[model samples]
Target: MKLQEKKELLKKTVYEMFPDAETELYHNNEFQLLIAILMSAQATDKQVNIINRNFFEFLKTPEDGLNLGVEEITEFISSVSFFNNKAKNIFKTCEILVAKHNSLPPKTIDELTELAGVGIKTAKVFLSVTEGAPYLWVDTHVHRVLNRIWIVKAKTPLGTDKIASKIFNAQDLAKLHDTLVLFGRYHCIARKPKCKTCPMLPWCSYKEKNLD
Candidate 1:
Protein backbone atom coordinates (compact mmCIF):
# COMPACT_ATOMS: atom_id res chain seq x y z
CA MET A 1 0.00 0.00 0.00
CA LYS A 2 0.99 3.64 -0.44
CA LEU A 3 2.38 5.65 2.47
CA GLN A 4 -0.75 7.79 2.69
CA GLU A 5 -2.95 4.71 2.54
CA LYS A 6 -0.99 3.07 5.31
CA LYS A 7 -1.19 6.20 7.41
CA GLU A 8 -4.91 6.41 6.83
CA LEU A 9 -5.39 2.81 7.90
CA LEU A 10 -3.25 3.27 11.01
CA LYS A 11 -5.11 6.40 12.02
CA LYS A 12 -8.49 4.80 11.41
CA THR A 13 -7.68 1.69 13.43
CA VAL A 14 -6.19 3.56 16.39
CA TYR A 15 -8.99 6.10 16.46
CA GLU A 16 -11.53 3.33 16.50
CA MET A 17 -9.66 1.52 19.22
CA PHE A 18 -9.13 4.57 21.44
CA PRO A 19 -11.62 7.26 20.64
CA ASP A 20 -11.02 8.93 23.98
CA ALA A 21 -7.23 8.86 23.84
CA GLU A 22 -5.62 11.74 25.69
CA THR A 23 -2.85 12.58 28.16
CA GLU A 24 -3.07 10.43 31.25
CA LEU A 25 -1.20 12.94 33.41
CA TYR A 26 -3.38 14.61 36.02
CA HIS A 27 -3.14 18.39 36.09
CA ASN A 28 -5.50 21.26 36.91
CA ASN A 29 -3.86 23.82 34.67
CA GLU A 30 -1.25 24.41 32.01
CA PHE A 31 1.50 25.20 34.53
CA GLN A 32 0.85 21.96 36.37
CA LEU A 33 0.67 20.07 33.09
CA LEU A 34 4.03 21.43 32.01
CA ILE A 35 5.61 20.37 35.29
CA ALA A 36 4.03 16.93 35.05
CA ILE A 37 5.42 16.47 31.54
CA LEU A 38 8.84 17.62 32.72
CA MET A 39 8.83 15.10 35.56
CA SER A 40 7.58 12.37 33.21
CA ALA A 41 10.92 12.29 31.35
CA GLN A 42 12.25 9.05 32.83
CA ALA A 43 9.03 8.35 34.69
CA THR A 44 5.57 7.11 33.76
CA ASP A 45 2.32 9.09 33.81
CA LYS A 46 1.15 6.93 36.71
CA GLN A 47 4.22 7.86 38.72
CA VAL A 48 3.89 11.54 37.89
CA ASN A 49 0.19 11.56 38.78
CA ILE A 50 0.89 9.89 42.11
CA ILE A 51 3.44 12.56 42.96
CA ASN A 52 1.29 15.39 41.65
CA ARG A 53 -1.73 14.33 43.71
CA ASN A 54 -0.22 16.04 46.74
CA PHE A 55 2.32 18.21 44.93
CA PHE A 56 -0.26 20.01 42.78
CA GLU A 57 -2.35 20.87 45.83
CA PHE A 58 0.66 22.70 47.22
CA LEU A 59 2.19 23.92 43.99
CA LYS A 60 -0.39 25.41 41.64
CA THR A 61 1.23 28.47 40.04
CA PRO A 62 4.66 29.98 39.49
CA GLU A 63 4.40 31.73 42.84
CA ASP A 64 3.50 28.43 44.42
CA GLY A 65 6.54 26.78 42.87
CA LEU A 66 8.70 29.58 44.25
CA ASN A 67 7.10 29.19 47.64
CA LEU A 68 7.81 25.44 47.67
CA GLY A 69 11.40 26.13 46.57
CA VAL A 70 13.84 23.57 45.27
CA GLU A 71 14.33 21.75 48.57
CA GLU A 72 10.63 21.38 49.25
CA ILE A 73 9.93 20.42 45.68
CA THR A 74 12.64 17.78 45.86
CA GLU A 75 11.05 16.37 48.97
CA PHE A 76 7.66 16.33 47.30
CA ILE A 77 8.90 14.54 44.21
CA SER A 78 11.64 12.47 45.81
CA SER A 79 10.18 9.30 44.35
CA VAL A 80 10.66 10.49 40.80
CA SER A 81 13.87 9.87 38.89
CA PHE A 82 16.42 12.70 38.91
CA PHE A 83 14.36 14.49 41.53
CA ASN A 84 17.14 16.90 42.49
CA ASN A 85 17.70 18.14 38.93
CA LYS A 86 13.95 18.26 38.19
CA ALA A 87 13.30 20.26 41.34
CA LYS A 88 16.01 22.77 40.50
CA ASN A 89 14.79 23.12 36.95
CA ILE A 90 11.18 23.43 38.10
CA PHE A 91 12.17 26.21 40.48
CA LYS A 92 14.12 27.98 37.76
CA THR A 93 11.25 27.54 35.29
CA CYS A 94 8.80 29.01 37.76
CA GLU A 95 11.13 31.96 38.33
CA ILE A 96 11.25 32.72 34.60
CA LEU A 97 7.49 32.32 34.19
CA VAL A 98 6.88 34.73 37.02
CA ALA A 99 9.50 37.28 36.06
CA LYS A 100 9.07 37.42 32.28
CA HIS A 101 5.96 35.58 31.12
CA ASN A 102 3.71 36.97 33.83
CA SER A 103 3.26 33.57 35.41
CA LEU A 104 1.86 31.92 32.27
CA PRO A 105 3.33 29.22 30.06
CA PRO A 106 4.49 30.37 26.66
CA LYS A 107 2.55 29.28 23.57
CA THR A 108 5.32 29.06 21.01
CA ILE A 109 7.95 26.29 20.96
CA ASP A 110 10.83 28.78 20.95
CA GLU A 111 9.53 30.69 23.95
CA LEU A 112 8.62 27.51 25.85
CA THR A 113 12.06 25.94 25.25
CA GLU A 114 13.61 29.03 26.83
CA LEU A 115 12.34 27.79 30.21
CA ALA A 116 14.49 25.55 32.33
CA GLY A 117 14.06 21.78 31.78
CA VAL A 118 11.81 22.44 28.77
CA GLY A 119 13.31 20.89 25.61
CA ILE A 120 11.90 20.62 22.11
CA LYS A 121 9.90 17.51 22.95
CA THR A 122 8.54 18.89 26.22
CA ALA A 123 7.66 22.15 24.57
CA LYS A 124 5.83 20.36 21.78
CA VAL A 125 3.88 18.21 24.24
CA PHE A 126 2.94 21.20 26.37
CA LEU A 127 1.75 23.20 23.39
CA SER A 128 -0.08 20.28 21.85
CA VAL A 129 -2.04 19.50 25.01
CA THR A 130 -2.70 23.05 26.19
CA GLU A 131 -3.11 24.92 22.91
CA GLY A 132 -4.22 22.11 20.58
CA ALA A 133 -1.16 22.79 18.49
CA PRO A 134 -0.01 20.50 15.74
CA TYR A 135 2.81 18.56 17.31
CA LEU A 136 3.57 14.86 17.72
CA TRP A 137 6.27 14.78 20.36
CA VAL A 138 7.64 11.28 19.82
CA ASP A 139 8.43 9.42 23.01
CA THR A 140 9.33 5.73 23.41
CA HIS A 141 5.79 4.45 22.80
CA VAL A 142 5.32 6.66 19.77
CA HIS A 143 8.70 5.70 18.35
CA ARG A 144 8.06 1.98 18.82
CA VAL A 145 4.52 2.12 17.33
CA LEU A 146 5.52 4.17 14.32
CA ASN A 147 8.38 1.82 13.52
CA ARG A 148 6.17 -1.24 14.01
CA ILE A 149 3.56 0.24 11.68
CA TRP A 150 6.27 1.07 9.14
CA ILE A 151 5.46 4.75 9.31
CA VAL A 152 9.09 5.58 10.06
CA LYS A 153 12.18 3.35 10.16
CA ALA A 154 14.53 5.36 12.35
CA LYS A 155 16.68 3.92 15.14
CA THR A 156 15.98 6.42 17.92
CA PRO A 157 12.89 8.36 18.94
CA LEU A 158 14.74 11.53 17.98
CA GLY A 159 15.40 10.15 14.49
CA THR A 160 11.77 9.02 14.12
CA ASP A 161 10.64 12.43 15.33
CA LYS A 162 12.67 14.11 12.58
CA ILE A 163 11.28 11.86 9.85
CA ALA A 164 7.70 12.15 11.14
CA SER A 165 7.90 15.90 10.98
CA LYS A 166 9.03 15.73 7.37
CA ILE A 167 6.41 13.20 6.24
CA PHE A 168 3.21 13.75 8.27
CA ASN A 169 1.26 16.95 7.86
CA ALA A 170 0.19 19.24 10.69
CA GLN A 171 -3.35 17.85 10.94
CA ASP A 172 -2.13 14.26 11.05
CA LEU A 173 0.38 15.11 13.76
CA ALA A 174 -2.24 16.82 15.91
CA LYS A 175 -4.79 14.05 15.47
CA LEU A 176 -2.32 11.26 16.14
CA HIS A 177 -0.67 12.89 19.13
CA ASP A 178 -2.87 11.25 21.75
CA THR A 179 -4.26 8.34 19.72
CA LEU A 180 -0.89 6.93 18.69
CA VAL A 181 0.45 7.16 22.22
CA LEU A 182 -2.54 5.29 23.60
CA PHE A 183 -2.39 2.74 20.80
CA GLY A 184 1.25 2.03 21.50
CA ARG A 185 0.88 2.13 25.24
CA TYR A 186 -2.05 -0.27 25.39
CA HIS A 187 -2.26 -2.14 22.07
CA CYS A 188 0.98 -2.23 20.11
CA ILE A 189 3.14 -2.58 23.19
CA ALA A 190 6.89 -3.10 22.98
CA ARG A 191 7.32 -6.66 24.30
CA LYS A 192 3.76 -7.93 24.11
CA PRO A 193 1.60 -6.16 21.52
CA LYS A 194 -1.96 -7.42 21.04
CA CYS A 195 -1.23 -8.20 17.43
CA LYS A 196 -3.72 -11.04 17.14
CA THR A 197 -6.65 -8.89 18.18
CA CYS A 198 -5.45 -5.62 16.70
CA PRO A 199 -7.42 -4.18 13.81
CA MET A 200 -4.25 -3.03 12.08
CA LEU A 201 -2.72 -6.51 12.22
CA PRO A 202 -3.19 -7.07 8.51
CA TRP A 203 -1.35 -3.91 7.49
CA CYS A 204 1.06 -3.69 10.42
CA SER A 205 4.70 -4.21 9.44
CA TYR A 206 6.01 -5.44 12.75
CA LYS A 207 8.12 -8.58 12.27
CA GLU A 208 8.06 -9.90 15.82
CA LYS A 209 4.45 -9.22 16.64
CA ASN A 210 3.31 -10.79 19.88
CA LEU A 211 0.50 -13.01 18.64
CA ASP A 212 0.53 -15.27 21.64
Candidate 2:
Protein backbone atom coordinates (compact mmCIF):
# COMPACT_ATOMS: atom_id res chain seq x y z
CA MET A 1 0.00 0.00 0.00
CA LYS A 2 0.98 3.61 -0.52
CA LEU A 3 2.14 5.76 2.37
CA GLN A 4 -1.07 7.75 2.51
CA GLU A 5 -3.15 4.59 2.32
CA LYS A 6 -1.16 3.00 5.10
CA LYS A 7 -1.47 6.10 7.22
CA GLU A 8 -5.23 6.17 6.83
CA LEU A 9 -5.53 2.49 7.67
CA LEU A 10 -3.30 2.85 10.69
CA LYS A 11 -5.28 5.85 11.90
CA LYS A 12 -8.59 4.03 11.62
CA THR A 13 -7.28 0.92 13.36
CA VAL A 14 -5.79 2.97 16.17
CA TYR A 15 -9.03 4.85 16.76
CA GLU A 16 -10.88 1.56 16.94
CA MET A 17 -8.29 0.13 19.32
CA PHE A 18 -8.36 3.07 21.70
CA PRO A 19 -11.44 5.21 21.30
CA ASP A 20 -10.82 7.28 24.42
CA ALA A 21 -7.08 7.78 24.53
CA GLU A 22 -6.16 10.43 27.07
CA THR A 23 -3.07 11.58 28.90
CA GLU A 24 -2.32 9.21 31.75
CA LEU A 25 -1.14 12.01 34.02
CA TYR A 26 -3.70 13.11 36.59
CA HIS A 27 -4.46 16.82 37.05
CA ASN A 28 -7.29 18.98 38.29
CA ASN A 29 -6.79 22.03 36.05
CA GLU A 30 -4.58 23.76 33.52
CA PHE A 31 -1.92 24.81 36.02
CA GLN A 32 -1.78 21.30 37.39
CA LEU A 33 -1.57 19.89 33.90
CA LEU A 34 1.28 22.23 33.01
CA ILE A 35 3.17 21.29 36.14
CA ALA A 36 2.48 17.60 35.57
CA ILE A 37 3.78 17.80 32.03
CA LEU A 38 6.88 19.58 33.25
CA MET A 39 7.51 16.92 35.89
CA SER A 40 6.86 14.22 33.31
CA ALA A 41 10.02 15.13 31.43
CA GLN A 42 12.41 12.15 31.48
CA ALA A 43 9.86 10.47 33.77
CA THR A 44 6.92 8.13 33.50
CA ASP A 45 3.27 9.08 34.00
CA LYS A 46 2.97 6.47 36.75
CA GLN A 47 5.81 8.08 38.66
CA VAL A 48 4.41 11.58 38.12
CA ASN A 49 0.98 10.47 39.27
CA ILE A 50 2.42 8.98 42.44
CA ILE A 51 4.36 12.12 43.30
CA ASN A 52 1.54 14.50 42.38
CA ARG A 53 -1.03 12.68 44.50
CA ASN A 54 0.30 14.46 47.58
CA PHE A 55 2.22 17.35 46.01
CA PHE A 56 -0.80 18.71 44.14
CA GLU A 57 -2.91 18.90 47.29
CA PHE A 58 -0.69 21.67 48.59
CA LEU A 59 -0.27 23.37 45.23
CA LYS A 60 -3.26 25.15 43.78
CA THR A 61 -1.70 28.04 41.93
CA PRO A 62 1.63 29.52 40.86
CA GLU A 63 1.99 31.15 44.24
CA ASP A 64 1.58 27.81 45.97
CA GLY A 65 4.35 26.28 43.87
CA LEU A 66 6.63 29.26 44.48
CA ASN A 67 6.02 29.07 48.20
CA LEU A 68 6.83 25.35 48.31
CA GLY A 69 10.51 26.10 47.62
CA VAL A 70 12.88 24.04 45.51
CA GLU A 71 14.06 21.87 48.39
CA GLU A 72 10.55 20.79 49.34
CA ILE A 73 9.59 20.18 45.72
CA THR A 74 12.74 18.14 45.26
CA GLU A 75 11.91 16.04 48.28
CA PHE A 76 8.39 15.37 47.00
CA ILE A 77 9.57 14.38 43.55
CA SER A 78 12.87 12.83 44.59
CA SER A 79 11.81 9.48 43.11
CA VAL A 80 11.72 10.90 39.59
CA SER A 81 14.69 11.34 37.32
CA PHE A 82 16.51 14.67 37.44
CA PHE A 83 14.52 15.72 40.47
CA ASN A 84 16.87 18.58 41.32
CA ASN A 85 16.60 20.24 37.91
CA LYS A 86 12.84 19.67 37.72
CA ALA A 87 12.44 21.11 41.20
CA LYS A 88 14.45 24.18 40.24
CA ASN A 89 12.46 24.63 37.04
CA ILE A 90 9.13 24.28 38.81
CA PHE A 91 10.13 26.90 41.37
CA LYS A 92 11.48 29.26 38.70
CA THR A 93 8.50 28.68 36.43
CA CYS A 94 6.06 29.62 39.18
CA GLU A 95 7.97 32.85 39.77
CA ILE A 96 7.88 33.72 36.08
CA LEU A 97 4.18 32.93 35.82
CA VAL A 98 3.40 35.14 38.81
CA ALA A 99 5.62 38.00 37.64
CA LYS A 100 4.85 37.97 33.92
CA HIS A 101 1.73 35.99 33.05
CA ASN A 102 -0.17 36.98 36.19
CA SER A 103 0.08 33.40 37.49
CA LEU A 104 -1.72 32.07 34.43
CA PRO A 105 -0.27 29.64 31.94
CA PRO A 106 0.64 31.40 28.70
CA LYS A 107 -1.59 30.69 25.73
CA THR A 108 1.04 30.66 22.99
CA ILE A 109 4.10 28.49 22.42
CA ASP A 110 6.56 31.41 22.39
CA GLU A 111 5.26 32.77 25.69
CA LEU A 112 5.02 29.32 27.26
CA THR A 113 8.61 28.43 26.35
CA GLU A 114 9.85 31.53 28.15
CA LEU A 115 9.02 29.88 31.47
CA ALA A 116 11.67 27.61 33.00
CA GLY A 117 11.69 23.92 31.92
CA VAL A 118 9.04 24.58 29.29
CA GLY A 119 10.30 23.48 25.88
CA ILE A 120 8.58 22.84 22.56
CA LYS A 121 7.20 19.48 23.74
CA THR A 122 5.91 20.87 27.05
CA ALA A 123 4.39 23.89 25.34
CA LYS A 124 2.73 21.65 22.78
CA VAL A 125 1.31 19.46 25.58
CA PHE A 126 -0.19 22.48 27.35
CA LEU A 127 -1.58 23.90 24.13
CA SER A 128 -3.02 20.64 22.89
CA VAL A 129 -4.56 19.53 26.20
CA THR A 130 -5.61 22.81 27.85
CA GLU A 131 -6.05 25.39 25.07
CA GLY A 132 -7.34 22.93 22.48
CA ALA A 133 -4.63 24.14 20.12
CA PRO A 134 -3.38 22.08 17.21
CA TYR A 135 0.12 20.69 17.73
CA LEU A 136 2.08 17.52 17.01
CA TRP A 137 3.69 16.86 20.40
CA VAL A 138 6.49 14.40 19.70
CA ASP A 139 7.64 12.67 22.86
CA THR A 140 9.92 9.63 23.03
CA HIS A 141 6.99 7.37 22.18
CA VAL A 142 6.02 9.47 19.20
CA HIS A 143 9.58 9.72 17.90
CA ARG A 144 10.17 6.00 18.26
CA VAL A 145 6.82 4.91 16.81
CA LEU A 146 7.00 7.14 13.73
CA ASN A 147 10.53 6.00 12.90
CA ARG A 148 9.69 2.34 13.52
CA ILE A 149 6.52 2.51 11.44
CA TRP A 150 8.35 4.30 8.60
CA ILE A 151 6.04 7.29 8.74
CA VAL A 152 9.21 9.33 9.07
CA LYS A 153 12.92 8.61 8.94
CA ALA A 154 13.74 11.34 11.46
CA LYS A 155 16.10 10.53 14.32
CA THR A 156 15.03 13.41 16.57
CA PRO A 157 11.80 14.50 18.26
CA LEU A 158 11.78 17.89 16.50
CA GLY A 159 12.22 16.21 13.13
CA THR A 160 9.35 13.82 13.89
CA ASP A 161 7.08 16.73 14.92
CA LYS A 162 7.83 18.54 11.65
CA ILE A 163 7.09 15.46 9.55
CA ALA A 164 3.87 14.71 11.48
CA SER A 165 2.57 18.26 11.07
CA LYS A 166 3.06 17.97 7.33
CA ILE A 167 0.87 14.88 7.10
CA PHE A 168 -1.73 15.53 9.86
CA ASN A 169 -4.36 18.25 9.61
CA ALA A 170 -5.11 20.71 12.39
CA GLN A 171 -8.46 19.04 13.06
CA ASP A 172 -6.81 15.64 13.35
CA LEU A 173 -3.91 16.72 15.54
CA ALA A 174 -5.46 15.85 18.94
CA LYS A 175 -6.79 12.47 17.91
CA LEU A 176 -3.67 11.56 15.96
CA HIS A 177 -1.38 12.43 18.85
CA ASP A 178 -3.38 10.39 21.35
CA THR A 179 -3.66 7.43 19.00
CA LEU A 180 0.02 7.29 18.21
CA VAL A 181 0.96 7.57 21.88
CA LEU A 182 -1.33 4.72 22.88
CA PHE A 183 -0.10 2.55 20.03
CA GLY A 184 3.52 3.13 20.93
CA ARG A 185 2.95 2.48 24.63
CA TYR A 186 0.96 -0.70 24.20
CA HIS A 187 1.60 -2.49 20.90
CA CYS A 188 4.44 -0.76 19.08
CA ILE A 189 6.73 -0.64 22.11
CA ALA A 190 10.37 0.41 21.86
CA ARG A 191 11.97 -2.78 23.15
CA LYS A 192 10.22 -5.82 21.71
CA PRO A 193 7.06 -4.74 19.92
CA LYS A 194 4.11 -7.07 19.69
CA CYS A 195 4.44 -7.41 15.93
CA LYS A 196 2.50 -10.63 15.84
CA THR A 197 -0.57 -9.04 17.44
CA CYS A 198 -0.27 -5.37 16.46
CA PRO A 199 -2.99 -4.27 14.07
CA MET A 200 -0.50 -2.18 12.12
CA LEU A 201 1.71 -5.20 11.49
CA PRO A 202 0.61 -5.33 7.84
CA TRP A 203 1.55 -1.72 7.11
CA CYS A 204 4.45 -1.21 9.52
CA SER A 205 7.65 -1.06 7.50
CA TYR A 206 9.84 -1.91 10.48
CA LYS A 207 7.87 -5.08 11.18
CA GLU A 208 7.86 -6.08 7.53
CA LYS A 209 11.51 -5.30 6.95
CA ASN A 210 13.08 -6.05 10.31
CA LEU A 211 10.85 -8.42 12.27
CA ASP A 212 9.84 -10.50 9.26
Writing each residue's lDDT as its tens digit, candidate 1 over 1-212 gives 78899888888898898888779999999999999999999999999999999999999999999998899999999999999999999999999999999999989989999999999889999888887798888889999998988989999999999998888888778768899999888888878999999887888898898888
lDDT, candidate 2, equals 0.86
In candidate 2, stretches whose alpha carbon ends up further than 4 angstroms from where it belongs are: 207-212
Q: Kindly report which residue stretches of model 1 are placed more than 4 angstroms away from their true locations once superposed.
A: none
Q: Which candidate has the top score in lDDT? A: 1
Which 10 residues in a row give candidate 2 its minimum summed lDDT? Answer: 203-212
Local distance difference test scores for all models: 0.91, 0.86
TM-score of each: 0.97, 0.91
Which digits, one per residue and each the tens of the lDDT, describe model 2 over residues 35-91?
Answer: 999999888999999999999998889999878899998998899999999999999
Q: How many steric clashes between backbone atoms does each model show? A: 0, 0
